[model samples]
Target: MIKVGITGQAGFMGNHLFNYLGTKSNDIELISYERDFFKNEKTLEAFVSSCDVIVHIAAMNRHEDPQVIYNTNVGLVNQLIDACEKTSSSPKIIFSSSTQEDQDNLYGKSKRDGRKALEKWAIESNGEVVSFIIPNVFGPFGKPFYNSVIATFCHQVVSGEEPNIHSDGTVNLIYVNELSAAFYSEIISNKNKSTIKMIPFTSTKKVSEILNLITSFKVDYIENGVVPNVSRDSFELNLFNTFTSFIPKKHFPKKYIKHEDDRGAFVEIMRALTSGQSSYSTTVPGITRGNHYHTRKIERFAVISGKASIKWRKINTDEVFEFILDGKEPAYVDMPIWFTHNITNIGDEELITLFWINEPYDQEDSDTYFEEV
Candidate 1:
């Protein structure tokens, strides 16, 4: 059982790391944490110092200006390195450097500097350090804003729009699952040696092929000469495959879910969310008929048609969070355990929700816990 600490635990890569850690059912103790150095360095360092393997992931991911990128990416990494140097007991540092070649762009520069910094720190501390220069990583639990080509492309396709490409560039893409596994393997499995392995891995497929495999959804393939020469099956299984046990399972009891919402209001809502458009109006209410909540159960909800507010409270906390269902939002919301939550039909006619859960309904673990209709 190895102790692990993950920084940048909230962004696309961070979320991927956390999701992977959450699914593990091993003696391994994983502590996933996120830090935006611009926000809180003290808390970030404290978190990094808490584990045996410190996975540093936070940095300025994408930008054009060299100074801007260096200041945000390289500069911040310097802070993390400094923190490690000062630590009474510095752990092995696993930095998520980019796979982009030695280019001059801000993104590339920062990643390069990060790699150097980690090497220097490891040498100074007489401790081991590993860096995985990952290529395009894409899959579930990934952020749509940055990281891989898949999220951006998937957003375009799902919104019924064409993606704009600067050039006909084919990237080496790996599923999120694969990248996560590689991370774990290098950090815990190979922590004994002070070696740097530049994995110019082979299992990379085109973005179009990846999009097809994950979902049945279709898209108009735009951008001439952009597709690569990789097979569909070639893109499966990587670091992320090991993290599948952490993912929540399907959870919708009974053979049926209520209300089909015939008018397609829910579909429009999903369109709006996916397109990154806010303030769209729903012509009808989504829930043509009911109010519901689960006891000791968790659920994930996605908007299908018109816009609506999902009001939910944590099981034993007064903290409440309201999310507006949209296509740009994640496909689902993770409901809390033993929480009282409900979706109101805020649209003009009817609203719709596409939801699922981690487990099936067991009478021993199921109930409305209330009898108010």
Candidate 2:
């Protein structure tokens, strides 16, 4: 079992690392780092001893003062090394450095100095170290004004304000989950290779390109109810998911553009560009709609009437995820690729569901796989 400890458990990168580690069913435990990590020697030593691997992610990147950044970061390294030295068994360390570390700037210098300190400690203790020079990581729940420029753009767009692109420089981004995946790789591979570090990147795009993509995603996917061709760009799918997750809940299930007359009204719920079809299913009380899986087909269920309990279970897994939806609160849940799923009418009345598939359903090639939930 791997006992891992993360420095910035509440911060963006640290939170993502925490979540990713939690998902893996491998025998791994998260070592708790106390709040007064620097001040309390007993807590620091105990925590350091408990961890088999330590991930240092807590560093001040936004401070204006160079000295503050330098002092805080280097001091963090000092405390960590001191704690580790007190323990007989030294743990492998993963330092979260930055691409800016090579630049001639204060933040860069601070990160560079911090990495040097870690390198020195690793040499002295004969411990392993892998300092990842991470790029800008963007994802959901990031602070609007502080954490990421993507968050700023998404917030501005959702707030109906003009997105401000102060700089046109290209920005590299890795979804936080992707970053976590990289870290998990390091954890699973306990080989000692600390001499020289290698930098990795997941994706990169121009600032204008990313901003424009998000804006289009909001318009086409959210407003016009178009399921995007996520196959076109995988990273863009992550960006779209992050942008949509930031949209205010009150603006969800946005009112459709209605064509009205004296008799009735016609509202187009959604329209896909190349393929896909909309489906409707009505389930009475004590009845279920689906107990199946899909290999390539992507589906979404929006409960437009009554109530439902949508459930998903990964192939050959015992765990099942359940999501409740009702017409009173309009929302949609997308199905997983290989996960078997179903929707049950939990309310007293009939359950009405609207389904969207990525491709037009064919009687001959439905692409649907069934499994009992």
Candidate 3:
């Protein structure tokens, strides 16, 4: 079995890599080097010797001291190379570098130098290295208030704080899952390279566009039962999923505004994409609800309170079906796709019923035809 070692396994991309590799890592032995790995000298050497592949994910990117960032980043490569050499092992090294290597800043120069150093060591010692200059990566479980804008925005908005945007410049984004897949491929495919650029399948969006979409998703989905139009595009859905992951458990079961008067109250209950929607309504005595047939949407009707009679009929058939049910029974009847159906209050009390549909309501193509049963 091939052994793979990951440094900084708890960090964002590192942890994501560990998880994605689990899908097809059955033949590979996995090792992790946390923050304390460098402190213990013997363990670092032994870990390098034990692995057939090493993913170097540890680095100081966001630091107050420029000198520290430069020194730590450059020193990290030297230490990794020295440890592997001391063990007399040529384990393939996967170094996670940043795209800032092209810039003239301190962080950029240090990363560029580190890449050069890795290349030099690989040539002189006849070792294998995969140095990847990756783009901005963001996904689930990323730390908020750190380097990830998506994570921080999700956290601040969930916490009722405004997102702080210094500029509305467009930002390139690559999901952590995509990067993790790249890591797995390098480890398993045995690809040796001097410098690898992970520029595949990145999405670009303006800062304002991102924040506005996420904000609209929050207001429309959480406050109201309306599912945001995340189905319109790929990035919208990704952003919505990321935003929902940060929502605290206490935020669930949120109440919505109900339009009520002397008649009764009406409100949208819940919505989903493929699984459909759920809603409830109350009807006075002798009041009948729903006289419609849907061509495609599968529906369910349950008598939640009082006594009710649910009736249905095929569009062009003389046969009519009726089900007498009460709240005490607590049973639901699934409505067929093309059946015209309705429910009526047959008792001397308010009849409450819950409804579920297989798809959210669409005005343009409602798939609903009006008919009386």
Candidate 4:
């Protein structure tokens, strides 16, 4: 279990990293700093002091002015280093830097400066800061343009537009999930300290080849400086793209069955709501069909397609409620927390329910209940 604190909680890359770390693979306690890394100095200090790892993914990587880059990227790293030094314990600081060989852009220079600061900090502390330099990570969550070549292509293709390639630059791009897995491998798996891990997309294929294979888009490969020579043979990426294409749409509001309530408990517990006797038939969906209850435990009626209302009530409340079991809009309906109820399908076909409850179900933690309503 690692106590990891993330600086840019809402930033695209940082968000992906946070989600990856939050998975079941490792026991991670995460606290998101919703403010800028430097602005929230006190919060960052407290977070770094308490945690074992401080992953600095908050930096201005793209800026027109060199001075702005230096101030934001390099200066931010320096502040973080100072905070680390002042902390009670020396937390391992891992910095995420970029890679661009040909251009001496503001982003590239700032990253270089940040790396130097990290090195200086490590030396000052006698090799205490464990750092990792990552290059060109592309994934599902990130927006296409910012530091991601593959995403740019994918974004263009998905939006019914053609991809724009600058000088056919062939840079190594690792999938976000793959990069995340690699980080876990380097950090938690590798116990050796006083290490600076640099995972460059050094051996990846040309951007031109990836475009040709994945889409029917036209690409003009630009012969650039020191770009990798490897041709794109991304079987994994292609296969995923193919599968995604066939789906034609994304699934929203993912569905799952609610089984938190036991059949026996629900049946017995629901008996208390019976202020008045109600007739219910078996052969319907069963006791487990309408197992979920709203947050306030409001009364509800399970309408049997052809049968009568099965009157039921909540235990302690003893609130009176009824159900319209037969028609599309069952009459005598007093559904809320008061009436815990279930209906049967007396007519042929699936029981078409025109169900209603007095109150909307409290979406969080209210659905799974054993009590009647």
- Number of the predicted model whose TM-score against the real structure is largest: 2
Sort order, lDDT high to low:
2, 3, 1, 4
Q: After superposition, how far is residue 343 of candidate 1 from its true place, in Å?
A: 17
Tens digits of per-residue lDDT for model 3, 1-373: 7788888777777766765554455777787666777877778898888888989887887778888989998888888888877878888888888888998888888888988888888888888888888888877666887758888988888788998899999888887766777887778774565556665647998888888887886787666545555442256655765676576644422333456789966654445553567889999999998898764455667675798888878554578878887775454565653468889999999988888775688898776777789
Candidate 1 — what's its lDDT?
A: 0.54
Q: Kindly report which residue pairs in candidate 3 clash with one another.
A: none
Clashes of 1: 34
**Location of the lowest summed lDDT over 10 successive residues in candidate 1:** 219-228
By lDDT, the better pick of 3 and 4 is: 3
Global fold similarity of model 4 (TM-score): 0.58
Runs off by more than 4 Å, candidate 2: 253-269, 273-299, 308-346, 355-373
Comparing 1 and 2 on TM-score, the stronger one: 2
Residue-level lDDT of model 2, residues 1-373, one tens digit each, is: 8999999877878876776676555767888665577688888888889999998998887776778888888888888888898876589899999888889987888888888888988888888888998888887668887788998999888778898778899887888777888889888885788844554667889999988988887788666678666752368667766776576544433434556689966655556663567889888998987888764455778887798888888555588878877776556777755467899999999888889886677788665666777
Count of clashing residue pairs in every prediction:
34, 0, 0, 12
lDDT of 4: 0.52
Q: What local lDDT does model 2 show for residue 191?
A: 75
The digit string of per-residue lDDT tens for model 1 on 172-200 reads: 76666567777767765753766666656
Give a tens-digit lDDT track for model 4, residues 116-144: 78778777775455556677776553555
Model 3, residue 279: C-alpha shift (Å):
16
**2 versus 4: better TM-score goes to:** 2
